[model samples]
Target: MKNFSEIEAMARMHHPDLDARLAAHGHLRTAQEIADIPDDRWLSTMTRCVFQAGFVWKVIEAKWPGFEAAFDGFDPVTVSFYSDDDVARLASDERIVRNGQKILATVHNAGFVADISREHGGFGRFMADWPASDQAGLLELLKKRGSRLSGMTAQYFLRFSGWDAWILSKDVGAALVREGVVDKPPTSKAAIARAQAAITAWSDESGRSQSEISRILALSTG
Candidate 1:
């Protein structure tokens, strides 16, 4: 519990003043607060989040040793070739998330990744092709990939990977309110200054990716 609390606090500290805006609108959110991480880390983190859909980060972080070992450090070329036998093996691997469905999706997504690479050069290139400034196209991609993971819930995971920009609605919003980043009673003032202060402080110390930040925040609230 203590460790979880610390992780959550770390997340709160990483926000770029966006939380108050979300809160004012009755939403929960995570945003692009990391400006120093390399592009490759962003790609790999996306693949990792796909693999970790329903699992805890501590579990994934601990098992990351084996995940890196098994998946060739999440090399898209290597993971894209994962076969049915590979899927079965991963389903039983105790060191990883081990969920059958998620394991299969990870492998499947790898194939899609390979296609994206072949047609566009690489995942990063594909990302560039995405119209970040266009909401409908972005949401379409989100919904398409999101179909595999219980409606748009998977969209949040994608957002963590930096593939999309999104805000959390419903329960996650309630969770944020409980975290004390915002007052539940509501007001007109923006808390962006406080939230950005927290995020800047947290970002300077941790090398973890955006999704990791979100997990840390959720764990803090949990």
Candidate 2:
């Protein structure tokens, strides 16, 4: 793969204001900041990402207050114990999206978050302790343990929750292919590993966060 500077130059060619755009995109939290985030917020973000999947994000955003109310502020300890009755009630509740499966996913993910919080003292601590270099491993863990947290959903959850992460957007995937990191958008385990390695190497060389590298890759493609 080419050096990250070369990739950045290509991005600048496409968008001359790449740096300013990147500065406004989003900020990565410090480990301390991440460790201080409450478990409820983690659960809330996770549920939002789950619900946003294959659905209209603007609608979700507009009705988010109802979602917050309906899910009991996404307190992991409370939502983790939601029963079948609770599921039925949420499904019938017009305040939220009312998707039964997604509601169920919220319940499952609450337990997932609560369990981690118990084990690690706090879910934020668990996330803070996870090394950024192994984001693929982190994503795999989310896929296996958290409900509806596979693929881009999991990536967005991590990103939105202030975890240092890279999203595999279409443009980023295209740029990866251009760099010969993978022959296609990385779906298979092997392909994803290759892409991760390429990004990790670029990060080491460029001293840029993975999210920034991801954005640069997307910009470079256009």
Candidate 3:
């Protein structure tokens, strides 16, 4: 396995300029900072990632107020029960992005939020209880339970919601292969497990957040 210092050095070599070294790094939100976020925020972030998956993120961000108003602040209980009429209405709503599939995903994801809330007393509780080392498991739940939240969408949801997530970006995938962790971007459970194990070990050895480790790895091959 490659060390964090080795990865950082590679990034530095790529950047070259002395000041560029510090400019190339990133950080993660601590669990304590993330644990107390409102349940609605979690749903909102998930929905945003869903919408932004194959679309322009800035367009979504610019229209987010419309999205908030259109979705009733993304209240899980309220959204989970959205009627057929509601779906039809949102399909034409000019205020928010009008992608039918993504709009419908909001309703489906609302049910997902409600289920987690019931299981954990609230989605925030689930976030607090979930261990970062087991993020691979959390990814599984997001894919199976959350609507449209598979692959990078699931990862971006966690990352945007302040989890110290490891993104399997193309560059990060290359770094993984270089480090002998995996031969390709992980798709199956076993592949993801191998990726997770290597990341967890790197996190422990480097004392870095998964986000930082992910960035370092991605940057290593850039």
Candidate 4:
């Protein structure tokens, strides 16, 4: 039930030399900023996060230009139409990572982006319209609708794309447990709900963005 100021005070206690006042987390984008993003860029970032999951990020970074070229700049409409032949081609393509499952996930997630775009005028609009207070709901949508977006990928994509969100990284989870929000990492539906509620309560109590809260908690507990 501690507010952000209290947590920040705790953080300052932990690291006395560093100023503990919450700076805006650099990674999160404002709603207007996120709304201005193109659908293609969204798809591209989503694809990158998907491929980067459980894999070396620098390797993906090194090959991103090839990924962009191979996927035709991640045009959602274009990639949504990729066929079985395209899957086979990408699987053997040296330009990008050769994981078959991840390659197919790109195609599926492209379709997901297209669907959301059509439903909400654009994917950017869909993202922009999502209330930050209900970030867990958006994460659930990503998990149910998108491929290879389970666990941390969706959160990473959100941060990378400038959407404000809390990343339940291992450190963040530990921080949550440390705060008595839950006794362990939130895995089951009930535990996850408890975690989200704890964060939402903190957001209300502190009037801070999820990104700031996440970093503050990480600093204090990690």
Winner by TM-score: 2
Model 1 over residues 61-81: C-alpha lDDT tens digits? 777778777666666656668
Model 4 / residue 181 / CA error / Å:
1.0
Q: What is the lDDT of residue 58 in candidate 3?
A: 94
Ranking, lDDT, top scorer first: 2, 3, 4, 1
lDDT of each: 0.51, 0.94, 0.85, 0.85
Q: Which lDDT value does model 1 have at 39?
A: 36
Candidate 3 stretches greater than 4 Å from native:
16-27
- Give the best candidate by lDDT: 2
lDDT of 2 by residue, 103-201 (tens): 999999999999999999999999999998999999999999999999999999999987879999999999999999999999887888888899999
TM-score of each model, paired residue for residue: 0.52, 0.99, 0.93, 0.93
Candidate with better lDDT, 1 vs 2? 2
Model 3 / residue 73 / CA error / Å: 0.6
By summed lDDT, the worst window of 10 consecutive residues in model 2 runs over 187-196
Runs with alpha carbons beyond 4 Å of true place in candidate 4: 16-27
lDDT of 1 at 210: 29
lDDT of 3 by residue, 16-44 (tens): 55235433443456666676787789899
